[model samples]
Target chain A: MKIVLIGSGNIATHMGKAFMHTGHQIVQVYSRTLANAQALAKLLNSTGTDSLEAVVDHADLYLLAVSDAVIPEVAAQLPQELEGLVVHASGATHIDVLDKFRHAGVIYPIQTFSKSVDLELTETPFAVEAREPADTSTLITFMSAISNRVFEGSSEQRMAMHLAAVFANNFSNALFQVAYDLLAQHDLPFDLIRPIILQTAEKVQNNEPRAVQTGPASRNDQNTINKHLQFISSNPDWQSIYQKISDLIVKRKENNSEN
Target chain B: MKIVLIGSGNIATHMGKAFMHTGHQIVQVYSRTLANAQALAKLLNSTGTDSLEAVVDHADLYLLAVSDAVIPEVAAQLPQELEGLVVHASGATHIDVLDKFRHAGVIYPIQTFSKSVDLELTETPFAVEAREPADTSTLITFMSAISNRVFEGSSEQRMAMHLAAVFANNFSNALFQVAYDLLAQHDLPFDLIRPIILQTAEKVQNNEPRAVQTGPASRNDQNTINKHLQFISSNPDWQSIYQKISDLIVKRKENNSEN
Candidate 1:
């Protein structure tokens, strides 16, 4: 498949590499910053450009790997009459945002990407959506070349999945930052809790997270919760988060018991 | 080393197996319930008892692997003039809780444990605390036999570590539960987000979590955050948590920039 990658950020870099790995041709790379596009295009052996008019119109797919807020604007600037599939790689954005194209779809990779970390894309699940049944098949085939895990879902389902990712990946990492700051305040190394973080993630792979949930909040251990609240009393932000999450966990546990 | 494990719960079960793995003899396992004690003791080829009077007096170490609330009562019931070192496996409970003993310390493993999952103890960091310097060496040697990661800290330091673990492990898992519940509501498989969770944790293994943090919250993308809030508006608990955490993240990023 011939591809034109839009946006020269983490997702574009990773996706371009994955497409190249699967023997697909990346014909052009686009970024508002010409240098950024050039850097990625050089690696992919493709043309680099900052202007939307320069996007190759004849590619098999135009993968808009841009930020969510920029998707609509980027989609508006694409060649309106282009005879290629236009897909945005965003979990939060709806497929209709690219409705201007004859062939519009989504190929949202349900994984976090960082430029510094090399990820195994084969196992990363890609949620695919398309306006036409034929385009869906084409998108699935394109995704299958890079990943084994692909699912067909509507925009609503994709939004739900994105929301869940926010909690699972985004919010959870925020909690890790909280942990890191807490440890650093006491002159402790983040290394002390790294094993536990990995183990916690490992447990959720097979078991239902709710079933294996172990903590002061899950147990409704008020003494420990109070102690933690007291410990973080000076930091009202953490105190509220600590209290709110604990209350939520305890309530969930209670609901589980009643059911 | 001769050891007596005084608890038959999750920590005791896992710790007993680890102690036996390192060639330390578990002389006895004690629990309020004889069946629970027997269940763990039978696996380690040790005696199981419910009565505190039956605890072996000659063991080299009496390991109190009990709950934080029960530690004081459990310690009170032990043989007062015992010759061996006494250590509690708790993060929140201070080492001073066992000050009645001539040789007192702590052997708090910083990893979350479940009986269903087998963990490689060699990499699990054990936080050791001792009343005397000689006992610290003894505790270190014993811990070294089971794990390469051992550190000495005072009670205050250990409590701080425990608080961090709650954020890193427990609260992080709670966030996973939130994700799981959200997906289940939409009839989506939890498998979709599992890869991201693993990758998020894998990144933290070598990188500072604060440096590698990514998400709407971390990015301060209020557009996506507002969209997420609207998506979850029906659930008040999640809404409050979402708002509080997003605000906190934005505030934190601002703080980071100032520094």
Candidate 2:
């Protein structure tokens, strides 16, 4: 498959490498910065350009791995005569955002990408949504070449999944930040808590999170809760966050019991 | 080291097995229930009894692996004539609670214990806070036989670590539960977000969570935040939680910019 890669960020870097490895031809790499585009293009052994006008639509697929806010603007700037399939690698944006082009779709990689890590694309699930049936198959076959799991979802379902990721991944990571902050404030080594964190994560691999919830909050040990409240009294905002989450845990337990 | 593990509960079950595997002789097992004590004793090839008075202090170490609330009452019942170190494997209880004994200390296993999983005690950290240097060394060697990491920490420090564990592990798991609940309310499969949850946990392993935070909350995208709030508004409690956490993240980002 002939593909044109857009954006030169973390996701773009990994996606470009994977596509190249799968014997796909990367026609050109486009980025706002010349150096960024050149860097990926050199890796792919392809042409590179900074101008949106230089984007050639001669390839079978054009992947926009740019940020959510910039996708529509970039699409609008593309030449109307460009002939190819277009896809955006965004979780939150709708498919209609690319409606200006004859063929539009989404090819979202449902994994956290870092440049240093070795990613097994087969483990990463791809959520593909297209404006047309033919476009869907093109994206599906392209993604399936790199990943073992490919599912077709509507724009609304993808939006909900994206929102849900915020709670499951983003919010959970924020809570970890709070924990790190609380520990550092007390001159505690964050490494000491690593085992517990890993084990907690491993628990969910087999069972439900609600089944594995523990601590003073889940135990309803008011004495310990009061002591923790005293400890975090100085940071009122964090203290409030702590209290709300604890209360929510207790309430969930109650709901589970009634059920 | 010769040891007698008291209370054949979750911690004792794992600790007793680990001690036996490390070639330490468990002289006796004591529990409130004779069957529970005997069950652990049989595993360790030792005698078992129900009464705390029946506890014969023949070993060099006595590990009281029991719940926090029962520690004082159990310690008070132990015979004063007993020799060797006496330690309770608790995260929150103070070591001085066993001050009546000549040798007293703590051995807190930082990981959550369940009966189904065979716990690898070699990686488990034992937080030791003893009344004397000799008792500390005795515990260090005994626990070190089974665990690689052992540190001297006061009851207050252990309590703080325990609280932090709640935030990092227990409370974090509860947040996952909240996500599950929200999805279930909308008749969505909890499986759809599993990949996101796994990635969220993996993100913190390499980066400080404060730096890796993402989502509508992290982006300070009011439109999406307001939409999520409206979606959960039927449940006022969840809506308030969503608001508080979102506001906290936004505030943290602001503080970061100012710095």
Candidate 3:
């Protein structure tokens, strides 16, 4: 398949590099910034263009690898009625945003990416969705060719999965930031908690998170909870966040008990 | 070292099993429930006794592996100071809780344990602390025999580490429950987000989480935030949790930028 990347962000850079080992051909790259476009284009030995009108219609797939808000605007400005499928690599945006194109689909790679750090994308799950059934199958097949964990889901599921990832990955990462910051204030190394953090993540790999919940919150130990709360009293926002999460755990425990 | 575990819960059971291969001898196992005590004692080929009066003074280490609230009560009932060190395997409890004894210390295993799963105890981090410097050294040496990751910390640092862990492990586990339940409502499998969760944890192993934060909240993208909140509006508590955590990320980002 021939491909054209429409943005030079993390997703675009990763996908461009991943396609390097595959049978696909990357023909053109486009970005609002020419240098960003040229940087990724140089990796694929492809042409770079800052003008949306200059996007080539020669590729089999043109990925709108841009932000969610501008996906519609970018799709609107692209050359109309292209011969290839037009897909966006967004977890939140709907496929109808590209309705002007005869071919519309989505291929959301469900993992964090940084250009400096190469990824084992072959193991990353790609959520593929399309407006038409045949288009969905085509995207699934292409994704399967490069990765082992490819699944076809509804646009709603893809969005829900994204939301869940926010809690599972993004929000949890924020909590980690809280831990890191608190430890730093105490003059303790983040390395002190690394092993325990690894074990916490490893636990959920085979067990349900609710079943394996631990700590003062899960145990409903008010003494420890209050102790922890008092310890962080100086940070009112952190105390609130602590209380909310702890309450969620306690409430869920009660719900399970009633059932 | 000669050892006796005072409680037959997850901590006692895991530590009892971990000590079986070492040079240490578990002289006795004590539990409020006779059967529970005998069950763990049977694993170590040691005796099980329910009465504190029957506890032998032959062991060099007495581990009060029980709950935070009952630590004082349990410590009060234990046989009066012999020639052994009395320590509690609690993350939140202070070492002075055993003030009635000659030797008081803490050996906190900073990992969640389930009776059904066997762990690689050697890799687990044990935070050793004590009321006296000599006792602290003893704990550091004993813990080092069973695990490679052992460090001596002040009681305050241990308590702070426990508080940090509430945010790192316990609160994050609660967040994972939120994600799991949300996905179940959408008829999505938890497996879909497993890789992302693992990657989220792995990134922080080498990088500060604040530096690698990602998500709509980190981006301060109100559009997607409003969309997610609307989708989960039926559950007010979840909506609140979502708002608080997202606000936290946005605020932290603002702080870093200001710095």
- Number of the top candidate by DockQ? 1
TM-score of chain B of each: 0.97, 0.91, 0.96
Off by over 4 Å in 2: A80-82, B182-196, B235-238
Compose the digit string of candidate 3's lDDT tens values, residues B113-149.
8776678888788889888899888889888879999
C-alpha displacement of B91 in model 2, angstroms? 2.4
Model 1 chain A is weakest, by summed lDDT over 10 consecutive residues, at: A210-219
Docking class of 3: medium
For candidate 1, give fnat to 2 decimals.
0.82
In Å, residue A146's CA in model 1 sits off its true spot by 0.7
Model 2 in CAPRI terms: which quality?
medium
- Residue pairs in collision within model 2: none
Computed on alpha carbons, the lDDT of every model, listed in order, comes to 0.90, 0.80, 0.87
> Alpha carbon lDDT of residue B81, candidate 2?
72
Q: Tell me model 2's lDDT, rounded to 2 decimals.
A: 0.80
Give the better candidate number (2 or 3) by DockQ: 3
Between which residue pairs do clashes occur in model 1? none
**Separate DockQ for every predicted complex:** 0.83, 0.53, 0.79
Quality of candidate 3 docking, DockQ: 0.79
**Candidate 1 regions off by >4 Å?**
none
How do the residues B72-189 of candidate 1 rate in per-residue lDDT, one tens digit apiece? 9999988889899999988888888898999999999998988788888999889899999999999999899889999898788888899999988888788888888888888899
